[model samples]
Target: MALKQSFSQKMEQKLSPQQIQLMKLLQVPTMELDQRIKEELEVNPALEEGKEEEEDEFEQEEYEEEIGEDERDFDIDEYLTDDEPAYKTSVSNKSKDDEEKSMPLSSGKTFQELMLSQLNMQKLTEKEVLIATYLIGSLDDAGYLERDLESIVDDLAFSQNVMTTEDELEGVLHYVQELDPPGVGARDLQECLILQMERRQDGDITRYTALKILEDHFDEFVKKHYKKITAKMEISEEDLKDAVHEIIRLNPKPGGSLKSSSKSLQQVVPDFQIVDEDGKLVLSLNGRNAPELKVSQGYKKMLQNYSEGAKLQKKDKEALTFVKSKLDSAKWFIDAIQQRQNTLFSTMTAIMNYQKDYFLTGDDTELRPMILKDIAEIVDLDISTISRVANSKYVQTQYGTFSLKHFFSESLSTDSGEEVSTREVKQILLEAVEDEHKRKPLTDEKLASLLKEKGYNIARRTVAKYREQLNIPVARLRKEL
Candidate 1:
C-alpha cells in the first residue's frame, strides 16, 4: 500500500483563547472569583482593580491601532445586547436598617498547626519528632492515618532520608493519637471510636460492653445484626441496645470536630439573589460576581512612552513587545470577566422567569418541567454553556438558597394530560416516605401505587430509579424496630 493525499473539507467550530477563558470564568462561583482575579493580577502586572482613567487615552489609541477591527469589535455593547435590561435593580423587602451583614474577618489556627503545636510540647528526640511529623502529614481530612506503617516508613526513608522502623512509627503514632481532638491519628473508624472510648473518665459497664463489641464483633455490629450480637455476647435485647447506644455516641469522624476550630469550614456564597418585591420576582447578580476591574494605568503609560520614543533600540523593542503582550492580556481578562457577568445574569434571569410560579409560591410542586435545552434556547446559548452556568452556581430565593441546577428537572405527564416537573414527584415521594411506618416501610411497588393514587402514573422501576436519585434506601434497608 502506498500513501495518497486526498482533499476533504468539514465544518468545524473553534474557541479563541479569550472565549476559552470566559467559559472557564463562567463556571466558577462568586466565592472563588476573587481568588481567580487575584491570581490573574499577580501574573499580569498590567491588570489591576480600579476604574480606567482618561490619562491612558494616548495608549488606548495606540493599542487600538496595533490590534485590528476584530479586536475593536469586542465592545461592551456586544455583550450587553437588546435582551439585557437597561437598569436591573436589586430589590429587597427589608428596610436598610434590617439588612443582614457579614463579618469581615475570621481568625483561627488550622488543624495541622494545632497538631504541630501539641507535638512540640512533647519531649521527643529529633528522629522521633521527624517520624511523628511524617505520620501527622499522612493523616487524612477525617483525622485517620490512612497510610499503613510500612508505606509511611518507605516514604520517610525515600522522601525525608530518615530511616525508621514500623514499631518506632507505631510508638510515635500512639502518642499522636492522644492529641486534643481525641482520635486524630486513628487508623480506621473502629480505632477512632475506641480511642475516644478509651478517654472516657467513667468506666461504666455500657462503655465496657461497647468496647468489647468494637474489639471483636465490629463486623456484625456494622451490619446491625442485633440478634447475632445479643446471642453471642449472652446479653438481653435491652442490654445490647444500651451498649450499641454507647457505641453510637462515640465520634465516628474524630478529625471533623476540629474543622470549625481549625478554620476549615467553607461557607456557601450564592451567585444570584431573587427577591420577592411586591409579589413580583426580581433577579440580581451577587455583588462578588461583578467586581470592578481595569488595566493598570502605569503599564499603559509605559507602553505609550515606548511607542512615542523617537529611537527604538533592540532592548527597547523587546520591552515594548512585552508591555504590549501584557496590556493585551489585561484587556482580554477584563473583557472576559464582563462577558462572564453578562452570561450569568442572562442565564439566571431566564431561569427565574421560567420558574416564577415556584418562586412566588415557594412550593416545589409549582415548579414547571424544564431542561438545559429550554434555557439554552431562551438565552440563545449552547447547552454546554448553560451547563457550565448551572453546575456550581447557587441562587438565594425568598424560600431558601438552592443550586441553580435544582430548577431544571425532567418533565412527566399525569393522567390529566398535564406536564409536571419531576421535582414535584420527588417531593411527594419524600413526604410519603417520611410519614411511612418504620415497622413496615413502603416498597417501590407500594410507592408506585401511592403515586398513581395521587394522579402520577409512574412504574415501579421508575419509582425505584427516582427513589435512588433522592438517596432513599429500599424497604428492607429502611425498615427499623
Candidate 2:
C-alpha cells in the first residue's frame, strides 16, 4: 500500500539579476565583447560613452583621495588633469544619441544558405528538393544529421503535404553525397569514405584500403585489427600495408568542407597577447574588443535641469528613468569588462608563474600537475568563474597560440610514487608508438610492459584508454603489413 499525497509543494529557484548578467558576460568571447557593448548602447539610450559632467566631480574627488593618501608617492596629478591629455580621445566625446539611431543592422548568409544555393543549381524535382531541403535543415552545426530515414519520411509526409518514401529520400541522399567535397551526405564515417572512394577513378592503394575497410571488417579496421584483416584476405604483408595506407588517406569527415567543427574563422582571434619587454614578460589584454562606453552626459544633464522645474512632463520623467537604467547598465557592463580583464591577467600571471619551468624551457615533461581549483584559489576567484575564463579562450605565446584549457592537465602518480601529468604519459606513449617497428606493431600489453620498465605502472586497459583519447588505433591498426 502506497500513500499518495493530494497536494505537493512546488520548489522554485530564481537567479539574481547580477548572476544572470555575469552568466551572459561569461558567454561573450573577447572578439564579440565590443559588439555586445555597442548593441547595448544602441538599445539603451541612457547608455553612452565616456564620463558625464556630473561624474567629473566624483572622479576628481577619488583622484584627490588617492593623491592625498601619499604625498611622497609619484604625483597622480598628471593622470587626473585634462591638461595632461592622458585620457583624451577624439571619439570618446562624440554625440551618442545621433550616432546609434542611424546604424544599419547586420545580415549575412549562413551554412544553410550556402547549401540551399547548391541545391537550387541542381536539376532536382520539386519533391526531391523538398526532401533535400528538409534533410539539410535537420543537420546540426557539425553537418551531421543523426535522425533516421523513417522520422524524416514522416516529417515530410505530414508537414510538407508531400508523400515520399524513405527509399526515394535515401536515393536523393546519395545524390547529395556526390555533391561538392565528395562525401557530404554519408550516414557515417565508413559510408562517407566509401562514397568518396566510389566516385574516385584512380585505383590507388589508399583507395583500395579505404574500400576494403569500409566494405569489410570496418569495426575491426577501426579498432586496428590488421592481423585479422590480413588473415582473412590472405594478402601479403606488403599489400596489407598498402591497403592500410590507402584507408588512412581518405577523409574521415564527409561534410567537413561545408561546416568545419573547429572554431569559426572569426572565433580563432586570440584574446590575449604575451610579449617580452626588456627582460620581462608583458601581458596585454586585447581591449580593442572592449569599446569605449560611458553614461549619456547630455541625458544626465537634462535630468538635472528637469529636476529643478516646477512640473516635469510625463515623457521627460520617463526619459529620465530610461536614461538612468541604461546608464547603470552601461556602467555595470564597463566595470564588468574591466574586472574581467584584471581577473584574466591575474589568473594567467599566476599560471605563468606556477608553470615557469615549462614556459622557460618549452618542455612538456616539466609541465606540473595543475587543476582549475589550484589557479582559482591562487587568483581568489571561484573555480566556475576560472573555468569560464579558460573555456574557448586562447593565449598567444611566442611559440604559438594555444587554448588556455591546454595547460590544465590531471595529475597522475608514477610507479615510483612521483606525481606527473597524464599529458607526459600520453606524450611518452605517442613517441614510443611513433618509433616502434611498423611491420609488427607493439600491442597495448607490450606498451604497458614497456611503460612499467620506464617506471610508469600503467595497465593495459589504461594504455588503451590513453591511446583512444589520442585518436590512435590499437597495435593491429598500427601494423603496416
Q: Pick the candidate with the highest TM-score.
A: 1
How would you encode candidate 1's per-residue C-alpha lDDT over 400-452 as one tens digit per residue? 99998889999999999999999999999999999999868899999999999
Which ranges in model 2 have alpha carbons more than 4 Å from their true place?
Answer: 1-27, 50-195, 201-235, 259-264, 277-279, 311-323, 415-417, 459-461
lDDT score, candidate 1, position 65: 35
| lDDT accuracy of residue 179 in candidate 1 | 83
> TM-score, each model?
0.73, 0.69
**Which residue runs of candidate 1 sit more than 4 Å off their true CA positions?**
1-10, 35-137, 147-178, 201-203, 232-236, 259-266, 293-334, 459-464, 473-479
Deviation of model 2 at 461, angstroms: 4.1
Against the unseen true structure, what C-alpha lDDT does each candidate score?
0.80, 0.70
> What residue pairs clash in candidate 1, if any at all?
none
